[model samples]
Target chain A: MEPDTQNGGGMAKLGIWLVVLLLIIGGIVVYGKRGEDTKKASVKEPIKIGFIGPLTGDLANIGANTKAAVEIGVDDINSAGGIGGRTLEVVYEDSQCTPAKSTSAANKLISVDKVAAILGDTCSSATLAIAPIVEQAKVPLISYASTAAKVSDAGDFIFRTVPSDVLQSSFAAKYAVEKLAKKKVAIIFVNNDWGLGLSKGFSEAFKAGGGEAVFSEGIDATSKDARSLLSKIKAIKADILYLLVMPGQAEIVIKQAQELSLKISIFGADPLEDMTVWNNAGKAGEGVMFTTIGTSPSDDFKAKMKAKVGSDEIIYSGPFAYDGLKILGKVIGEVGTDGTAIKDALYKVSYEGGVSSPKIEFDQNGDPKEAGYAIKIVKNGKPVVVK
Target chain B: MDIVPQLIANSIIAGSIYTILALGFNLSFSTGKFIDMGYGVMMVIGGYAVFYLSKILGLPLPVGILLGLVISGLVSYLAYTVVYKPLRARKASGAVLLIASLGVLTALQAVIAILFTSQFQTLSGLLSGNRVFEIFGGAITAVQLTTLALGIFLFVILAVILKYTMCGKAVTAISDDEEVSKIVGINTEKIIGSVFFISGVIGGLGGMLIGFDTGIEPIMGLPWLLSAVTAVIIGGIGNVYGSIAGGFLLAFAENFGIWQIPGEWKSAITFGILILFLLFRPRGLFPK
Candidate 1:
């Protein structure tokens, strides 16, 4: 028994020394791994960008298309050997096309993802919601589709590839009064930030151009029934009807108006240039005229998008989104990943080969300076650029 | 334009839609003794079934409509047998049943959205062309006229059934006292199930008509459901004839009220009438 006890005590001491030696080795390995991780993080870290848009809900189709375009842009940049050997990474969050959801997404992108910049919030309301957050974080926010005039004053860091509604509405007003020679106008606008801005801007411009807005009314965006409103518009009997609504609502409005046998000329904004509207509205959408921003996509780029998205009818915003990413990448490459530095660099960008606009430059409000609108008319159930 | 004739025409068209929805809601609510939120999704099912048949499968309009009605009825009956019947056997409270109905509504809406993408689809091809008529200087469409006629026909048929038929008498008895009627050999479950099927058919018809008139979407059910519930509350819950009267009254109030106000105030006017009726005449215009 004594010999057994002595042997057991010796084994215990040996086991303790073995544990100590193993712990020492484990500590060295862990310390070395942590050091390597820090070195990689400092030198080879990816340039993370945040993308917030409606990935689900009512506007999911538009969101998906925009995301696809942005991905193509990322692929183009990375294939050109990424910005200084650091790969571009985009973290996407669904804004649900709502201000509340956009705010939450912006918080996550800024505080959690630690992104260098944000690209998105396609809707005007959502972009407006995230503006203050990004401005506070000193991060640059580049929107590809938001067109509200209020976005100009949203923040110093807020920028958009799409021209403001102020420009489009004013141009539309001039064309209606001068070109179409319509003196009396009836306006029906969707009751939202984008629609309200267009309505106010168009009405003011029309009145300034010596045209009278005989009737003006705001309809809820989700409203499906417009017979009563159309009846009222019919009674007023204006020369031109300005419908500032989305493509879905626009289709219903046009069809219902045709059913009512109202012979007034109809006009719309850029959103009406969708195949969905043309297909759904049937023959009623024929001869309807609208305004859209001009694009200069290269033949190769167009072919690439057609192959990537499996459709040739790319949305107008898709090209703008592609340009937005390229612009952001150029600036990021020139000025590094500092948000303030990128914001400063965005003002000086003179890009020549953007997919949407031929020459991309920013004004004081971070708006494109050399942008103009073009007229499109539906002919033979398809949108034809009016020269 | 003089707003009076347009307002009257608008009221009639809106009233016709509410009447059909309210009738079905009243029939189901009387026997079930629960709000039956699933009733709303059933309307969506009816609309989508008709869309799938007429638009996708290239079936005739009439055949698509008949199949839509049958599909909705069978789905409603299944909902009761599979979900509500077992819960009733366990003696669940009305609140629990109502919550369960909401669950059914959400799940069914998601399923429909998955199948038919959440985009607005129109039934423009079915009608060929919209025929318009002038009534007292107000414009009305052929579809609107059909909706009015269908509402009247359903009302007359339902009134006759409830007042003069044995099935109607059995349904009323079961609704009044399910356990007592069961004791008296009324087969309360069968009567209630039949009521559900009949109500589902009417609701499905209403859905198809609305889809034909305007357009249909996966989330189209909730608005129609709200209108139906408002009519039921104003007419007096559980009263068949009261719902008819309530439907027209709410329509007139909303249409006429929005004439002077902005058009955006139209939905608000509907709830305003509901609130006034709830406060002043809590039992509704015609209580059982």
Candidate 2:
């Protein structure tokens, strides 16, 4: 009986020890699962990109249209299983078309959001403001619109989907000197980075191409009265008036010129190609001509944009913005979220199926290799390509 | 083509617009004893109201203009009752009132932006076709001539009223000392409200004219307000006729200043003149 009692005690002790071993194994399995969960969470996190543009201010139309195009690009990418099975997210900030606001917005996007890349800053002023910030942070900045010539020298990380104003301005110069045979031209431009760059580029190219710039004036973008400037241009009696202004301001200048019976021919940059110019200026914009970047948009892209934006009146920058985001996604997918790696991939990438152009490849200066400009003329309150 | 005649015409046109804006600003500032920053947004309201009435709703031009004027006056009266009057009842300081006015300005501008999308719009289509008249080798539009005529007429009428009429005397009395005027049986609030209405009408007219002559945008008000404020400061803040002289003087300075310099320096020249006037002749030409 004593031996039997001792055996029972030994069996109970073994049972307790076996229960302890089972609990220990279960705890290890649960901990290992937690560790696996954390790894998966890190891998499944959404890839975030930042967008900055004039979402609420003067250039809101352009910014909003570009945003719509970017949305389409994002939707397409995500629908195709996103970039390497992770969802893509875009955080937008309003630049207000101003430098001060854009700098702060860019800083917020870079420091707070810790985004991998940035798209937009539609205005040249805003792009130039954020260029140094993104460059310093080693984040790739792809401007969809900003066409200032100085943007070419912004930074290594700075790139634009749209061609520089250099090409458009040179094209304008050639069109004025060779096509229209205008020797003495009066240049009136908005007093902003883009306008100033166009003015400089057009003047240099025109002079180099054996045409004379008789008078040049930079009108304040906020100034409504161009009568004084128009008078000065009239005094010079140039054959053509080259306007480097936006659609709204361009409409005003054209109407005012008509009211003053100033009969000089008017030429402008890309912004004048919008329906706004024709609608506002009416018959005054009848014979106006301008140079615009890129070929005509593809029918598929146009239809998609019309569906997305709820209007057929997409701005000139819309297609380029779409292409910009797609290129960004492709680069990110190819090389991952590292800014340096993405930028390097971008430099080496040659995207062919973008809406902006048939083939888009960046040169050393971060400009597109095949950026070409087309001339458009207004007829019956509509922009028609000049054949 | 000598630029002198054109420069003179340009200065006169700009001066006319400034005169109208200054007169409106001066009326409110004098009677209210505070800078009504919201007064700037009233111009936008006026322009947009006309746009909605004529362009959007397909009303006749005259009807749209009349309704726009009435709407502008009513909106200003509402602002006084809704915003300034309550603050005044609380005995708010001028600084607080100024801040409140700024808030009103920002809110109103944002609302306009939301409704109309900050794009520049024109009212030239309402005029059928703008006609040009050549004068002394300078070109003038029918709109500019009308603006000048309206400015001159309003200036004369306002001057006459201020100098001779009972209502004008009451306004002046209230402006000089509101508490004293109230003690002396002047309905101070009523007078201030009327002054606001009158200023709003004048500002609306200025906006409509400018819209016809050039174009109008949500941000159009601030530039006009800036010019008007400069005129008021240079012309003596409380004086109506002084604002006219100051307006013309500034227009001339701005136009002539840029004649020798690049056009980009126009704003610099304008601010430079303002600074010079503030430094040397604080009371301005024809001081109150």
Candidate 3:
């Protein structure tokens, strides 16, 4: 009776193995069939593009805002039936606002992802780091926020929706000298591409306009103590203090400057458009004037961004980022995904009624033509546009 | 340079903060006999605790501060028990313990970032207003002056306690020889645990004061840690007074060093001194 039971158990085990084998065979066949289906569906494959930004670092706030705006651009493109029935998709990579990381991210996007075009690298250093690579690959890259003046000569394939610091620096320098009647300016900037570019340009412009640059110094990005620098500037008796620092450091500099009783007119670049800096600085940031890229989002775009980000306050580059992706879509629609073709077509592609600017047109340097600038002053704990 | 007075004031303020940091780190280092790299994050923990409790939860300033100190102390004690103690029982090498402390530092910093969203915050905003003080033709803030006083006060209190108290004797014995200390009827584990708690409190105080003076970030501890470690080594690693002297010396070198150069070279000047000390004066300026 025991032997008979054992034989019955063996027979049951054999039956179970047979069923499992059959199921494995069936799964492979089903999976292979789905794979073929995907191949057939390639006709409707999405248009691929790459995006690079500082997703998780000191500059992450800017990255988050620009990334959301780009996502909105992708949504807008798809909802409008996409470009020639193919949906738009973006491959996002975090550069962390460093040149080395940006280079690696660009390489991955170009080689691994094989994206048709690239949209970002929010920091000027990151953009410059990848410019030669994109230029070599003949890939057209457009920047949404980088404003460093040297970006104008980075590469022919490089383009930016925002104007270069050359324009903004001259604008600010003129305003400081002519409008504010400030003769002596002390320039302290973060020792990075953005700060270096803006500070040097502003100093040159100010000096050329018959204003004296009493002192110009560079500090590390993570520096929290500015007492010595402030004291030196104060001793030199500068009437205007132009700060070219990241938003976080801006608060420290302003507060420390206030504590030392070095009361002077404080000015900054576009990065100060952030309300977080003013809020952190509190009353210390009062009357701090800064220059930012001039562009107004349309009501429709503003409403979309509000619903998308759940806040009416869009980042300063939000409209520019949306316009950048949309312009790429338009260019890709006119010309196929060929790199040089896209590069050539971007110059001819004149987009009007865009959210960032009223009209977007690329010039000889691949920069937007005649981009305007706006001056904002911190008042009562908020940045109010004065010009 | 007419900026001499301000430079001196800046050095003193920065030096005091570093002195406080060095004192906390040396206490834990002496007792544990291993570099507690994780000691730096205690400052971040304390600063963030107060920021959340007082700034966000609307708790009273003193209550928030006391709770913050306790929280940091508890975290340090837990780290010692759950990580360092177990590793020490297994006879881990100094290198192994150092790496473990690094892991602790990275993990705690990430946790803080996740909770606070990595935004820089200032506790000074909660104060009604900031008062400026003048000294010898140099302007100093009320916060800076208080930070200076606290650093000196902590140094004296620690010096007295370590020289006279029974707990201090036990810690010194353990630091000298842990096995010998255990065989001599000393409760080594309990004493080390308490030492870690004290270290955390001192580190937390430094952090809170810096937050009020400048601001706070999860990454803030690393730079401060680098400075303190350099101070500890240069001041004679186990000597309490060495840390104070080393802290002030490094600050003076850094502040005055940048007088003729660009401010961007400040860190370069600091690490340069550190490397010189490591090569020429490994036992430090005040070697025991």
TM-score of each: 0.89, 0.92, 0.91
lDDT of 3 by residue, A1-387 (tens): 999999999999999999999999999999899789868977788889999987766666778788888998999899999988898999999997889999999999998878899987888988999999999998999999898888989998999998888888889999999999999999999988888888888989999899998898999988998888898898889999999998779999999998888989999988887667887999899999999888788888888777877876677777888899999999999887899999999988899988888899999898999688888998898888995
Residue-wise lDDT of candidate 2 within B1-288, one digit each (tens)? 799998999899999989989999999999999999888888888888888899989999989988888888887888888999999999999999999988888888888888988877888888877888999988888899999999899999998998799999999998889999999999999989999998988888888988888878888877788889888888888898888888898898888777777788888877887888899988777666
List, in the given order, the native-contact fraction of each candidate. 0.45, 0.73, 0.61
Q: What is the TM-score of chain A alone in each candidate?
A: 0.88, 0.88, 0.88
Model 1 residue B20 distance off true place after TM-score fit, in angstroms: 1.6
Backbone clash pairs for candidate 2 read none
State the DockQ, from 0 to 1, for candidate 3: 0.46
Candidate 2 structure quality by residue, lDDT tens digits, A1-387: 999999999999999999999999999999899779857886888898999988876577777888888898889899999999988899999988899999999999998888999997888988999899999999999998999988989999999888998888988898899989999989998999999999999999999989998899888888877888888888888899999888678888898788777889999988775676789889988989988885567888788889987878778788888888899899999899999998898889999877888888999988888887888888999888898
Q: Which stretches in model 3 have alpha-carbon errors above 4 Å?
A: A1-41, A133-138
Q: Which candidate leads in lDDT? A: 3
Q: State candidate 2's DockQ.
A: 0.48
Model 1 lDDT tens row, A249-300: 8988998788767788999998886677887888888999999877777897
Of candidates 2 and 1, the better by TM-score: 2
Q: Put down candidate 3 lDDT per residue, B22-63, tens digits, no spaces.
A: 999999998898999899899999999999999999999999
Local distance difference test scores for all models: 0.86, 0.87, 0.89
State the TM-score of candidate 2 restricted to chain B: 0.97
